[model samples]
Target: MTKKNANTQALHALGQSLWVDNITRQMLDDGTLQRYIDELAITGLTSNPTIFEHAIGKSTAYDAQIAELSRAGKSGEALFFELAITDLRRAADLFKPIHAATEGVDGWASLEASPLLVDDAEGTIAAAAQLHRAAARDNIYIKIPGTAAGVKAIEASIFAGVPVNVTLLFSREQYLAAAEAYLRGIERRIAAGLDPKVESVASLFVSRWDVAVKDKLPKDRAKEKGNRLGIAIAQRCYRAYRELLAAPRWQKLAAAGAHPQRLLWASTGTKDPDAPDTLYVQALAAPDTVDTLPDKTLEAFADHGSVGAVMAPDGGDAEAVIAEHGALGIDDTALAAQLQQEGGDSFKKSWEALLKGIADKAERAGNAASKAGLA
Candidate 1:
């Protein structure tokens, strides 16, 4: 419906996987999510606090469910999970056959713990395990932030044999840290006489990098603005990902049947109207990497997304391009830190807003019940 001979046709033909980056209860129940899966070649899906917050606050879709949960004394974070897991589990079920068909290499959905717990190592791990348990499905990957605390949680959770999607990574260093945590966790599991083969992914967010450096990228060219920063960063990270997998440590891990957590490209929507909506989708195509794109981006890509040259595993010009920005007094590390902090803060804001909205709904529902009883 979006486009004939869609970009996904080329992407799937080339062996790269495309994943839809958003989900909703309506999407699941109405077969919209499944239709995307069938027509769009979408093998996976991802969700976060902001996504859940919006899906809950902006629609009557979740109201009846929320009302019932409130009656059972569920509120706040617990209430939110009840809603999200139910939706994700259904989506995961739809993807289950694809997952099995691919031998666990594809067809997965992600659920992140509270963004408020990003800096809380203990809290993140606890929430991750709790959500994983509550979901009770194998195709679901519990999402943990790739913050300092989250790195610790990633290692621990993986060791505990929980599949994880490491989210919020903004740079190569951050991605490497998350990878190392996975290594340590798998190594520990090996030492404990347990299977070290933990399924995981490092989600490298794109577009935000451009948003972080909108003015810094060489505006000397028309295409040099908007999403270029994120693409360059992702190109660079893909190079690192190639190198790390070829290293001896990872070779040993791979030899032991551990699935290397693939690097996923996230936040791929083009924010600038001047740029092609499918900018991120076209540039970051590589085998074994996942592109979790927003719906608009997906539609744009499906319409006109042509097969571009696959990203070089060697990371062509990424460091130098990033260095050009770094030379402009843009502290790359500081920017990563700032972005992460902002991301966490935004999640917290959404979480609180969702809680307040839920509270209001519960109050109104209570009043209606009271009126009905009195009548």
Candidate 2:
């Protein structure tokens, strides 16, 4: 395999896409997003409420729009969507050519619904469809968490012709569940006489596994094994993905015109400052999968990156490494559950914070307008 960023590009050459796990208005306004697409081989983007909260909170670029939307009676979630959709649409358009170029295999942008409904299967599905339709862009995906209820929602969303990006997955099991949901949804489409090839991707989170286990064990075990845990988990999921693609059940779906649900690596940034900056990028590089890097990580890889050997087709030593952790008294299953739950909560918090920021900004804008007699 080539060195770091070289390996990342090699992975892309092998059919996997490198996506940035972030989005921002400035990225769009200043052409940074376009540059990433052009130079870094990043083909997609993903965003959550936290990303928006930070983008809007620490800047004044959105204040004028908040003021305008506030005057138009939009506030809170409604206002948030208005702003988010605008940015996502711009990104979707930028990726539209790639979408068309790849026949919808690449060039996608993802926006998640409110995280508060993670357990509300129907509600999550409803919100995902509503958001996707509102965006009016085919390359845009509605992100759904991979909770049990979320799996249900994912299946239903795919059946209803909504492209989905499954988020918040922690374990190989959870990733498989998300994949099953995507396939079931597509099968339902074929059964219902609808086109079954709605594009989708299942995003398995990396890095956080190391974060959760960092302090649980002694020095050697707890010491960052660099990207060992995350890359292992990802490798296992990729093996399963390859099996699913080759399975007889899925083969029938493909025969009927359904697209395979691609695997995506989420949260690819290193949690350990001491680890190589591109640890996740270098180790988890594989074909037909995705590694979604944060902005800083992208720059790091672009500048001084070298991808290591290609991930093993049989997952290399992932299971044994996981077993080593298990021997150290870590319950991998329970931790996966905990990580997923926390992931859901984390997003909900960000969503709430984003809404609060919007509300506050709108209020301030409203006052400014009132004082200026622009109201």
Candidate 3:
């Protein structure tokens, strides 16, 4: 209802849930997060290793807690989860009203499973269950990658009643694979007479596709193809998402109380400096989908972005656009695999750095506590 953020409110009015892609304890403490919810129609949030690395490593807000946890003999992943879950629990509580009002359709917060378990299905599954249990909140989603192994874990985790946010998806095929896994899990739950309303969102990384192919474009065609791949891919995936929901398979599950796994647009922040700041946000607006925007993009959209026509359910021009890029030597399939692998690798690196940063901080905190005779 705030006049200043009318653009964002309009988008929400279109039935798309706008979720912030970053989370930090500082935002929670300072009421910035709450203001976004109140003014900008932000209904949900998500966090990953990189976001945590920056939040914990770059800010002193978490130092005292890290110190206390260190003093209690928690270190490494155990210490990190304590900090993460604490922040996410606060966020989840803030969104609890939205979650309840939507009957669990919106107002959720996501914390990713360990990137180190990207290829370890069993490890990912166990970690997801453990993290979900630890968070002890129904609205908190344990993010799992959509890797070959992760796909296996997704089905099992969903069957186990852990709401999953499937991350790092890049292509229509990959998205379908993750969706299939979700369907299988829900099917099993129905067969076993368990609750079939396990919620989920399959995240498709948009800007990363453009970032991956930007430099590879032919010089003459660069201008023409600069920032279109990601949108095209998203459009294609959105079509699949729409079709999937209308299928008899999903309809049956729906009758059995299963919720449709919403398609989420991730990595939506414009990576190209030349592209409009709110390019992805404006382009991907549609009903029944979630678009997770970075802080800058969210602010930019709130200020000046206009919602265009919603995406075509039939994927208008997406295939032709994809073919154009393909003819220029960009292979969508291979690139999707490469992007996913690179994304997993990048997150793994961040995970290592995050753990190391925590260890270093904990050591400093411990030494300081000892010097003060409190250890």
Most accurate candidate by lDDT: 3
Candidate 2, number of clashes: 7
lDDT of 2 by residue, 36-103 (tens): 87777889999987899899998887887888888899988888899989999999999999999999
Q: What is the C-alpha lDDT of each candidate?
A: 0.86, 0.86, 0.95
Please count the clashing residue pairs in each candidate, in the order shown.
0, 7, 0
lDDT of 1 by residue, 63-95 (tens): 888878888899887888888988998999999
How much is 231 displaced in model 1, in angstroms?
Answer: 1.1
Ranked by TM-score from best down, the candidates are 3, 2, 1
Question: Which of the numbered candidates is closest to the native, going by highest TM-score?
Answer: 3
At residue 185, what lDDT does model 1 achieve?
96
Name model 1 segments beyond 4 Å from true: 1-6, 216-226
